[model samples]
Target: MSKTLVLMRHGKSSWKDNLPDDERLLKKRAYKDIEHVASAFKHCLDKDFVFKSSYAERAESTAKHFLKQLGIPETHLHIESDLYTFDESSLKAFLYTVDDSLDNLMLFGHNPAFTNLANALGDQYFDNLPTSGLVMMHFKNSSWKDLASGKTILHLFPKNLR
Candidate 1:
């Protein structure tokens, strides 16, 4: 069976407040973008994927908004504190640890991790993965441990979606 991985960058976050980076919430435009992207992207997915989000407030909020817009249950979302990093190697290591039984894994977090990971593990090159951007890579390998390069099947950005 083929394995699929979807990497999503969190929506634009509010910087008006002096709050810590991890505590920052999504801006109004972010919510709009997330909704639009999620609604359009949801149609391309299969029902049995595992969804995970970084523990950061902005990322978690983005994940929740996406789930709401996609009509996916909140029960399907997992908050991973380790995913908050901006390093692609950390993200790749995390992917390697995912259960082999799960064929599809979706991650919501920050970048240049997402952008770098897409370039390292995908056939298509990405200059940047903007806020609310998503990239899906399909691999022939059944195990996440053996996941390396794969075909970039879907790449969606909020600006392009609109």
Candidate 2:
């Protein structure tokens, strides 16, 4: 069975200047971008699709906007505190733990790491995955444990929808 992976960077987040990084929220522009991107890919999502986000408010709210726009049930979403770390090693650790039962996994998190993860898992290389950027790929392996470089099926940037 082919596994599908959707790696999306959280929408542009606000800087309260004094607020903690984990409490930062999404900007108005990010909401618009999330709507556009989520709507563009809604049809491909299945009931088994799982939306996972970082514990950070920005990432969590980004996933929330995506679910609201896509009309996907909240039951499919998960908030993992470890995702906030933003490292390839942590990303890999998380991926390895995913059950093979769910083939479609959507990850909402920060850039650099998200950008790095996609490049590591797909043939396409992205220098930067912009705010609200989305990268969808398919793995030939049957299990997430076997996931490696796969086909880069789609790339969506928020600017494309603007």
Measured by TM-score, the strongest candidate is 1
Q: Give the poorly placed runs of model 2, Cα more than 4 Å off.
A: none
Tell me the deviation in Å of residue 98 in model 2: 0.5
Off by over 4 Å in 1: none
Candidate 2, residues 52-157, lDDT tens digits: the string is 9998988888898899887777777889987887788789889999999888898989877888999898999999999999999999888999998799999989
Model 1 scores worst on lDDT over the 10 consecutive residues at 39-48
lDDT of 1: 0.92
lDDT string for model 1 (1-162, tens) is: 889999999999988889999999999899889988888786776548899999999999999889888778899999998899999999999988999999988999999999999999999999999999999999999899898889999988999867
Q: What's the C-alpha lDDT at position 92 in model 1?
A: 90
Error of 1 at 42 (Å): 2.1
How does residue 8 of candidate 2 score in lDDT?
89
Q: What is the overall TM-score of model 2 with all chains considered together?
A: 0.95
State every prediction's TM-score relative to the real structure.
0.97, 0.95
